[model samples]
Target: MIAQDIVIRPIITEKSMQDITKKKYVFEVAKKATKIDVARAVEELFKGAKVQKVNTVHVRGRLKRQGRFEGYTRSWKKAYVQLTADSKPIEFFEGMM
Candidate 1:
């Protein structure tokens, strides 16, 4: 898959945003995307923010049943990107009520 298709979306949460203030950003990424790909994508998307490090995790799908057949939530990858101290953090969602 192309780099554009690798990153699904940023995982925006109060805790994650707090992390962002400290130079970390979490993202829900494609299952097959590697750390290098994630780092590159974030660096590109965030407009020159230097990527200090990239960490990826594999989250297993959860099994569930709704009074009938069982089903599983889709598995996904989570990436925690650390920005360089000199780089500014990205703020796509801020100042919102």
Candidate 2:
């Protein structure tokens, strides 16, 4: 898959935001994307940012109910990308911090 197709979107949460300071960014990735795919995608999408490592997590769907209707949310994959110490930070998140 292409770089843009592998990386779905950035995950913006309190935990994810804190990790940015350490050069670790979080992204919601395609279900079939592997660690290597995530690493490559991040590197390609953000120039000057070198990816050091990538960790992936499979989040299980959770059950929810509303007025006698119950269903589970869709399962998704999360990727944690760590950048090299000397690499530049992702500009997209720079203004957010």
Candidate 3:
């Protein structure tokens, strides 16, 4: 997959923003994507940045109930990307302020 198709978007919340400041970043990736895919995607999106490490998790959706109906939400994939020390950390929401 191309870089554009790989990284859907950077997940930058208060939690992740703090991480970015600390040099660690997290993202919500496609459920079907693997660690290798995530690394490639992150590298591509970050423009020549090298990924030091990649951690992926399979998130099971929680169940919700409305009235008498009960159903589970869709599961997703999460990736924690650690950039090399020499590489500039990813900046998604940091520039907003």
What tens digits encode model 1's per-residue C-alpha lDDT throughout 1-97?
Answer: 6667988888877788777567888889998788888888887877868999998989899999989899999898999989899987575744421
Best by lDDT: 2
| TM-score of each prediction | 0.86, 0.98, 0.82
- Per-residue CA lDDT of model 2 for 1-97, tens digit only, reads 9999999999999989998899999999999998988898899999999999998999999999999999999999999999999999999998898
Model 3 Cα shift for residue 73 (angstroms): 0.8
Question: Once model 1 is optimally superposed onto the true structure by TM-score, how far is the C-alpha of residue 52 displaced, in angstroms?
Answer: 0.2
Strongest candidate by TM-score:
2
| lDDT digits (tens) for residues 4-96 of candidate 3 | 665566776777776775567787887777788888988877775689898887889999999999999988777888888888755454474
Order of models, best lDDT first: 2, 1, 3
- lDDT of all the models against the reference? 0.82, 0.94, 0.76
Report the Cα lDDT for candidate 2: 0.94
- For model 3, the local distance difference test gives 0.76
Q: Pairing residues by index, what is the TM-score of model 3? A: 0.82
Residue range with the least summed lDDT across 10 consecutive positions in model 2 = 33-42
Q: Please list the Cα RMSD from the true structure of every candidate, rounded to 1 decimal place.
A: 1.8, 0.6, 1.9
Model 3 ranges off by over 4 Å: none
